[model samples]
Each structure stands twice: as C-alpha cells, then as structure tokens.
Target: MRTTLLFAFLLAALSGFAQDNFTITGDGDGFQEGDKIFLSYRSVKGFIEDSVTVHNKSFRFSGSVSGPVRASLYRNQNPKYANVIFDAATVYLEKGNITLHSSDTLRHSANAGTPLNTDYDELRAALRPYFDKLTTLRDPYELSDQEQKDKALVARLKSIYHNQVDLMVPVQFSFVDKHPSSYVSLVTLSELIRDSRWIDKVEGSFSKLSPELKSSVLGESIKQKIQLGKRISVGTLAKDFAQPDVNGKTIRLSDYRGKYVLLDFWASWCGPCRAENPNVLSAYNKYKSKGFTVLSVSIDEKKDKEKWLKAIKEDGMIWTQLSDLKGNDNLPYKIYGITTIPANLLISPDGVVIAKDLKREALHSTLANIFK
Candidate 1:
C-alpha cells in the first residue's frame, strides 16, 4: 500500500511538469504545404530560434519558456534574402496551447487561447484606429521632396501626428493599469519610456505593477532605464567625459565650459543623423559667434573612422567632432544613457542640461531665444 501511494505522487509531479510546456499551432490559408515558418524568442539561455515546414496549410512549434516572452513568427520566402520577412506577427510565448489564424497575411493574424495573447489582442484592437490614422498621416509617398521642404505643410502634418499619438498614450496606460501582473503591460511600459516626455508617468506606472511583475527580467531593465533617465533629465548637471578627436587628441566636455554647447550624439551610418547634419551646421554657423558651439560625438565603430571623417566634411560641420571609436560603448554614451542617434543636449555655460533632443525648428528657436 505504501509503495503504490508513492508511485501515484510521482506520476502527478511529472504531469504537472508536462503541463508547463507550450504547443503553438498555426493555421493560415496563405501557407502552402512547403512553406517555411520561423519562430524566434529570448530564453534564459539567450535568443533561441526554431523552424518548421508547413504541412497541409498548418504548422506547429513546441517549446517551454521560463516566463512570458514576446516572440515573432514569420515566413521567409528565400533564404538568401533573409532580411525580407513576410506575414510577421508578434505573440507572447507562455505555457499554453496557443493558436494563430490568418486568412491572408500574418501581419493581420489573430491569436487566441492564451492569457497574454488575449490581452495583447485586446490592446491592439483598442489602439488600431489611432494606429491607422497615424499610418495614413505618415505615408511616405504622400509628400514629395518639394512638399517636404515646405515648412508649414510639414509642421501641420507633424502636429496631426502628435495629436493622434497623444490620444493613443492613454489607452496604453489604461491597459497597464488594468493588468498590472501581465507581461504585456510590462512590455508596453518599456516602450512608453522611449519618449523622454513620458518618463515621469512611465515611472509612476512601473511602481504600480504587481510585486511579481516588478521582479521580472524586463521589469528590472525598465527600472534601470528609469534611473538612467532621471540622471540625465533636464535640470540635472551634465556628466562630463573625454574622448579622442580625429587627430587622436583627447578632449573633455569641461573644455567647453563658459560656452553654450549643443552636445550632439550621432553616427555616420544613421540616416536621420545624416539628414539632420545640415540643420546642425546651420545652427553652428548662426550661433558660434553668440557663445554657442556644437560638439559632435560620433558613435561610429573603429573600422568606420574614415566614413565618420568623410561625413563631417560632406556635411560641412566645422565645429569640434570627437569619438572614442567604441561604437555604442563609448564613455559619453554610457554616461548620458543615450540609446538613440541624432540626440543632443543643450547645456548651459554652467554645465546644467537646459534641454534635450532639440531638433529642426525647436533647435533654431531655442538658440534664437538664447542669443536674442
């Protein structure tokens, strides 16, 4: 009788472990029998990838995750053109029997039978209208080069885009507020922090998350980012750092003390940075005599030093340019917690950060007001 009881308990324990596994089944009318499907997600061990060929317009992937993880599923038509992803859809990978259905492109795929996925679908549905409007407003072919150069027209378009995004922010906040324990909520908050304007609110929302969620991997990352954000936020003293210039002469941020400086962060490979160089050059030329100067810090890698020098000459950026040639690991980048290019801080002569991420008309107007 004792031996039989022990066997029963062992069987139940193994059953519970098996229940933690996940099986994902996909059904798509667009998928042919030979079509290939790819799944990618991060695990405790790091990034993991799996692939399977479609059988009878369906595919399946079985795996286990330590916790809820955001994952992507897509089809790559040609292995040689791996960069091209088709019918891609994002789904949360958790323990469950999840189903994906798409009559056409997976971009419009629907997921069900999973807690995180259900919440994600609901949130996406709620924000679809705003996203649609923003998409239409930002259609690249909607404006010609000449039309893009029209400042008034561009400003009006930008105003509309900002208004749409403003309305969408609250929906995301509501989702997080309603589902404090959901991994989807944590992911949403992480994205919200990217816009520095929302840091305060993001921090507040982060605080309200369930204790378990707060202790999650992504949660800790967001917490660190929030701390970094506050450290470099406006009204704080800008941290000083030194880097080597093209001449291999080390220069310090403190060297520019007593002068208004636009401490610019950029890289040669960044398209937006290259496009904004003309504006930076214009601001430097107009304000250099008025106690204002530009100090550009390139995040280019060691191999791209020649490209960085070429871009400077091409853009006619005559002000001081510096780089440690450490790619994204440069000291100043870590000090300021810069995650994006074409970012700049307008620092006062006294070494306080007066403003940040100033670009286009805002950059000109701020300098004009200061030098006026």
Candidate 2:
C-alpha cells in the first residue's frame, strides 16, 4: 500500500499573502553605481515554486509592477521590517539609477528576492517600496502578534506568487511541453489541480495543452478513487485488473464469476492491514460458510515470500491470500489505485467493487446487512 499525503497551500499573491521581494546578481557581479536596476515579478501566475533567475546587471526599472514590487535602499531604513532587506555601507539602493555591488562579496549588494551565499547589507532592489510601506505602518492593536505575523507572511508570498504564475506556466509549459518525452506539465499541473472547484478548470486547461503535454500532465494527478458527491459514484462496475496470484497463478478480476469476492489490497508490513486482520479473519470465518471468499493481495517486497507466508499463518489468516512478492507492482495495487494501505473493495458475486475504505466495524456490519 502507498502512503500519500494530501496537498495543502493556497494560491500565493492572488490570495493576498506575499511579501514584496526582488534580487539582482548578474554575470560575476558586473553591475555598478548609477546603473538602472529594473524589477518586474509576479506571484504564482504559474506554479508556486516557479521564478526567474537573472544574471544581467543592466535592468530596466518598471517604476510600476503588477504585484506589489518595490524599489528601496540598503542603509537608511526602519529597525522592525528592515531586517527583511540587506544592508551595505552607508550606501542605499533607494534613488534612481541606484548603484549596486560592494568590495566584499560577503557584504549585501542589491537583490530584491531571497539572497543566497551572501551576508547582510543585501538590498531588495525588487519590491523595495512594498517592504518600505510595510515597515512604515504602525502595528495594529486589534491583531495579535501571531495573527499579524501570519497575515504579513501570506501577504508577502501572495505578492510574489500572483506576479509569477502567468509568466511561469506559459514559458515553462512551452519549453517543457515541446518534447513528447518531457513530462513537466504533469509535474507542474499536479500541484495546481485539486478535489475542489479548481478541478474542472485545471482539467479543462490541461486537456487543451498539446497532446505531448496532455498525457504527462494527467498521468498521476487524476483522482481515481470515489470521492463523496463526485460524478463517479459507488456501485459502479469497478475497473478490471489482471494480476498473478501466489504460485505464479495469473488472476484476472473479470475471471471471478458466480461468486462474491472481497479483493483486499494489503501488505504484511502495513500496520493498518495487520490491525484490521482480525476483523477480516472474523468476516472470513462467518462468510466462508456462506460462499463468500476473500482475495488478500499483499504488496510485500519480492524477496519476502517467507515473511509474507509467515505473516498470514501468524495472523491466522485462513482466506485466499495472494502475492507476487513484487511489492507495489502486485495486480490489485495497480488496478485499484492502491496509494493507501489496507484498502479493500467489497465486490458483489458479479465482481463490482461495492465499497472502499471500509473500516473493520463498518465492514462487518456491511457484510451482515448484505448477506442478510
């Protein structure tokens, strides 16, 4: 069974939580004083992590930007949020054609975005004004310290996220989707799609991408499980799968005819599966007398056949347990989308997966109700 973590994170700047930011480090630090420093950035117009890396010294000043970028200095600043930027000798990148760079590579120079491999005195040539505005504001009494901090942090990220999303996706998508072999879109869009309103919109856009990009985009992202209130409902004929059983016996789910089957996807190593073993064992004991059968598919590693067989005997598992000892590649794990452990499908005598994620207690009652 696979252990998957659900996604959590709001759209950055568009959600209004991004700190103003910028940076400038070009071609072995060729920039000089009176040189124009230009900054234009966005927040999450593309992917959250996507951003541009600049290696140019002469940059045009936007004077005005899309998502809360600013132009500020290193030296003269307030104490509170001033820590947000870098500091240089009495020199500040505040005025027009702001000069940049210092004798000490360790010293702060001019960069609006996050700095790496540099000490203090680094100025945020980008988003300077926004940080300035933020620092100048008096702390509001209504908001608690933590609350204010949280609000400020989100605001900062939003500012960056919103400005970059558009540029990031188009350029990155164009470059990545260019090759049939490239799978950047899938990786890129995976973080964007969710089980919410955004699903349709994201899916639609994904579908419109070039054929080369489309498959890569949807590969791992599409939700296969039955979500509550989703268009895909319970009682639907489950997808058929072909997997080999123990002793090298091939098992096609469609081949199970005329008998109700419980395709239980589990592993001996999974705690949840082991914990629920007793309930399954109990169910087997009761239903085995009534013609119901279980197919315990183990995702144990290839070398652990003895361990797999031993776990079954130790747990007193009496039903038909099958495993190829190939871990995740076992039949049921792939056919049924087994990203989680201890998963089961209560198939009718005809082979339809009736229920999923059924806890032991619920499984017992459900079986009783169905059989009765």
Candidate 3:
C-alpha cells in the first residue's frame, strides 16, 4: 500500500477553539543576519504562511492557534532552488514557547519545549531505527536491472519491507493509545491509516480514541474515511462516474462494462505512481487482448495538464487516461474514498470490485491467473 500525507485534510477538520498563543524561537549555525525563514501552518481561516528575518543569528515567531496544528519552518522559498536547499523542520504549534535548534540546516533541526513537539520528537526517536531498516529494504534500485526482473528476489524484498511496516504499526498505535488526549496522537493515527492494509484494526483503534479526540475535526474525517472505505471493499460493485479523457471526450466506468477493468488512480507529480506505471503498462499489454483494459484517473491539478499529458506520453501508457483536473477534489477519487496514489480497483466483467491495490508481482500474477 502507498502512504499519503493528509496534513491538509487533518488541518481542515480542526474545529474552532479559544485562541491560544505560541512563540517559536530558533537558531542555526548556518543562519546569517537578515536571512529569511518561512513558517507555514493551517489556521481556522485556511492556510497561513508567514516569514521572519533572522537577527543576530536567531529568529522568533509569535502566533495564535485555536489548537495544536502541525507547522513547518523553511530556510528557502524560491521555487527553483527550493528542492535543492530543502532545509525544513516540522513542529506542532500549540500553546506555549517552542524552541528549535540546528547545527547547520533546518532539515536536521530539533524541536522541543512544547508538550506536543516533545512527544513528536520522542515518537520519531523511537521509530527511527524501524524507518531506517525499511529504507534499506525498500530501495528498488539496490538490485541490478537483471536482478530486478527476478520475481523471487522482488517478492522477498517486498515481504521484508512489509514485515518492517508491520513491526512499526504497533509502535504508532501504542503512541495513540498512550497519548489519547494529545493532538500528536491523532496525527500519528492518521499516518497509520494512510499505509495500513488492516481496515478493521484501524477502525478499532479509532474507536479507542478519547471522546474529545474522537469528536475533533480530524477524528470525524477519519470516521468518514473508514465508512467510505467499507463501501469499496472487495465484493462491492465499483461505483460509476464520468470524467473527460485527454481528447476531451466523456468516459464513464459503466462504458467499460462486460470486460475486466482496472480503475487506476494516480498523478504525474507522484514518484511512486510513476514508478508503478511500468508494471501497470506491462499488465495492460499482457491482458488487453484477453478482455482487460486499464482506465487511469489522474489527480493532477488543472494547471498541470501539460505535465499530465507529458507523463502519459513518457510512460508509454497506451491505455485510456482520464481526469477532471481537480487535484484532491476529483469527484470519482472522493467517491471511491481513495486517499493515496497508485491505488486501483480490479473490476470483474459484472462490475464487481474483485480486488484492489494489486501491485508489482501481485499485479502480474493476478492478471496471469485471470487470463490463463
């Protein structure tokens, strides 16, 4: 399963609360006088972005947040150089004074002096080893091109990667269980839900949250996601919707009835989605003549139509591609409750969702079996 960060969704769900003040003080060895630092977080009004100038090699910011909201500090904002100088730090903005320290770049900064930030740091410390292990195990390029073609080697790598994820899930859930009232707990649960394959476990864990936490904006959003997830579970008929193809022709899911269809949800900006395209293309080639076809829905923004078209051509995706150019609000995307990219539904000839999220070797094996 692919994981997507839903910070925007979580921030949007926040309810109104009495205003609480926060102050952030930071210093970095690499900072110079008059250097600009940008801080961004969600507010009740919507997204909030502000910048501060360094004085005497230190910077300070004061703000009011209704409740704890995740905020990021950036060293650079130039779009062209942003990726190159991607120095940033995340801290939970809450009621109190928060401190940030970095020897060189904000990327390696440490946040403290606030309850939520402290807990966030502790959680990161606890999970660092597991994340490191997963990093080492999940590098697809670690193997030679010929070795990557070996199904057994790929499967083994995937199995090991999943094992690491399984081990990490409990630690995350335990943090939520231990810090029921902490806003950080809600954030942790949201992250877990993003990558978790176990829906029942996710639902159960959500149910265990404190009433106050459960009724919070993020909680209600999560509740709705779980409900929507159940609707598209295996055996449920795939929901039908219409979207415009690249040539501006309307296409509907029902139009593809009487043949197997893979409802592929992806975006050009998504690295994982791009990486998985080759596998999807391979599956399409192997099964297209066998009454199977791929229908891709891109969540690319309206402004990125060129990027979308360019990606489709570069990926050599001969399959039909569709999108509404509505980014996250893409109608069919929300209808299916998809929160992550590289998600798909394998619909049987009768339009029943036979399987979902098949990838890598699983995609090949499943298609092989169906065609055989």
Candidate 4:
C-alpha cells in the first residue's frame, strides 16, 4: 500500500476522539541559529502544521489535537539545502507537557513527559539502526551486467532487506505486549496490519487495550480490520458470488472449485495492477495446464467499460474476467475489504484461500511449490 494513503486513512480513522490542547518544547544540537523546525500531526481535519524558530537550540509548538496523534519534527529548511526528518513520534496531547530532545540530527532524538511518547522513543531507538541499514541497502542504481550475473548475491541482498523488516515485527509485538493499555500499542498494531497474515495476532493484542483506547479512532479501525480479516484470511472458504463477465455470461467463484483460482481485484485505471499484468500472465501461462486459472474482478465504473475492455485486450489477459462496473462500490472489492489495487487471493481446489496479494516472483515461487 502507498504510505501516504495509509496515513490518510489512519487520519480519517482517528477522527472520533476528545480534543485536548498540547504544548511541545524541544532543544536540539547541530542546528544553526534561526533554523525553522516543523511539527505536524494527522487529524480528521487534515494535516495540522505548525512551526517554531530555533533560538539557543530550543523551540516549541502548541496546538490542539483530537487524540493521540503520530507527529513528526523536521528541519523546515529546503530539501535542496538539507533535510533532517525525525522519526514519527506518537504524541499524547491528553497527557501534559511533551518534551522533545534531539542532538546532531533528528535521527538521534528523544521524548519524555508522557508514557506513550516514552515507549515510542524506545522503539525508535531500537529500530533506527536496522532501518538505516535498510535505507543503505535500498539505494537505487541500475544493475550492471556483472552484478546481474551473480543472482545468488543479488538474492541475498533482497533477503537481507526483507529480513530487516521481519525482524521489526517481533520488536513491535513486544512493545504491544509490554504496553497493552497504551494507545501506542494501537498505533503499532495499525502499522502492522499491512501484512494481513499478522491480523489474527494483532487483533489478539488489540483485545488487550484499555476500553477507552479500544473505543478511540485507532481502536475502532482495528476492530473493522479484524472483521475484514475473518472474511478473507487464508484457510477460510472463498465466498461464492456470481457476476456477469464482459460477454454478459454469469460466472461464479464456485465454478472454479476443482482448480486453483486467482481471484484478482483490480481496475483499468489502476497503474500497479496494470504493471503486474505481465507477471500474472506469466504465472497463468506456466500453471494453466496444471489446473490453475485466473478470475479477474474489476472495480471499474459503467462509463469506463470501454477502457476496461481495451486494457484487458491490450494486456492479453486471456482468462475469466468479470466486473459489476460499480467502481469502489463493486461487491467483490467491498466484500474482500480491498483498499488497494494489485490485490489477489490464491485459492485451493477446494475453494479455500491459500495465499493473498502474491505478486511478481512470489507468485511464481508459490506456483512452483504448489505444482512441484
């Protein structure tokens, strides 16, 4: 999922909280005099942006927030000059007198005066080195022919990148375990929901939150996600639905019971979905004779039917394609709780969900294992 979209959704989810005034004070090192610093938080009303001028290595921002919000502090200088962005800190305005302290750079920052911020500070401190290494490993450059020749070494770097991310999950889980009543745990679980495989475990941790916290925006959103998880999670039987294909022939998910089916939720306007078509085509071609097939359910609206059909033909998707032509109101997407494109469910011959959102190499690797 796109980071900004997730943050936007989270902002909407956090709308139902009591308002409280907040005051943030900070002192920094390695910043010149008169440097501007920004403090912003996401709210239902949109981004709450505020700034303070650095005087004697100290600054402050005051505002009102509906609840505990994920906030950031950054050097308000032009990116072309220098960009120093602090780790996103969960600020509990409901708790009083928040203090932010950073030295050398915003990466080495600390917070106090609230339990939530304190716990978040610890998490940031522990995760910083791994994140830094991940950033270095992910530096973009074209692969040289010599580098391409060493597939094993290339795969190792990719593995390291993924491992760094997986390693943080346990650290986050531990934080939730230690601070069951804190809203920080809710925020942590919200971030973890990107991987639906962890939904069940996250829901369990969510159950540990205080009633007040559970009723907050983050808490209610988690509940909705848990419900969504129950419906489409792996091992659950795929829901049966009949929708008309492009030719107006009714097609049903149940009809593909004896074959592995990829229930693809996408749209013609979805760039990521279009980009993934070739990979899906490759998987379909490779596995079709082994009782595998794809069932694409588009969420395109009625007016865009021509565009949808054109894309299908251009993409060479010679498979079962259907759509209700209702855009986001399409039944399959709504039922599956699909918020993003390029999402899919790999179902077994018995119609049980075997995996989900398998893309590119993961799709091929899973198909290889299944047909091996």
Per-residue accuracy of model 2 over 1-372 as CA lDDT, tens digit each: 122222223344244543333333322243444432223223335312112223343323222222322223323233234534344222211222333444432133433222221211222322344455555544332345575456444344434443343333344334324432323334444544422223444455455556544443245344332122133225888677666666677777677666677778778787757766766777888888776778778899888887888889988888777777778776557766565677677788776767665554567788898889
The lDDT values for all models are 0.85, 0.50, 0.84, 0.79
lDDT per residue for candidate 3 within 110-217, as digits (tens), equals 789999998988887778889778767765636788987785676677657666767988888778777777888888777666642655677887888889888988
lDDT of 2 at 217: 20
How well does candidate 2 score on lDDT at residue 54?
31
Deviation from native of the Cα of residue 16 in model 1, angstroms = 15
Q: Worst ten-residue run, lDDT, model 3?
A: 1-10
Model 4 agreement with the true structure over 1-372: per-residue lDDT tens digits:
699999988887776455777788877686678878766667879967777788998877887777677786767643334544343334555447788777764546687877777877777777887788777775212357687456455455555666677888887888888888877788889888756657778888888878998898678888887787567778888889999999999998999999999999888998768867867887898899999999999999999999999999988899989998999888888888875677899999998999998875678889999999
Each candidate: RMSD to true structure? 4.9, 19.3, 8.7, 8.8
Looking at model 1, report the run of 10 residues with the lowest lDDT sum. 77-86
Question: Which consecutive 10 residues in model 4 have the weakest lDDT in total?
Answer: 79-88
Q: List the residue pairs that clash in candidate 1.
A: none
Task: Report the C-alpha lDDT of model 1 over 1-372, residue by residue, as the tens digit.
Answer: 999999999998877445257888988888777888888887767888888888988889998987788988878553335755646888888889988888975677788889999999989898989988886787422578798677457656655666777899999999999989888999999888876667789999999999988887788989988887776988989888989998999999999999999999999998868867777877888889889999999999999999999998988888889999999898898899876677899999999999988876678989999988
Q: Evaluated with TM-score, which candidate comes out highest? A: 1
List candidate 3 segments past 4 Å from native.
Answer: 1-17, 28-35, 53-58, 77-81, 102-104, 134-167, 195-198, 240-244, 247-259, 268-271, 289-291, 299-307, 323-331, 368-372
Model 1 stretches astray by more than 4 angstroms: 1-19, 29-33, 77-86, 138-167, 269-279, 285-290, 310-316, 339-342
Clashes of 3: 0
TM-score of each: 0.81, 0.40, 0.76, 0.74
Q: Model 2, residue 168: displacement in angstroms?
A: 38
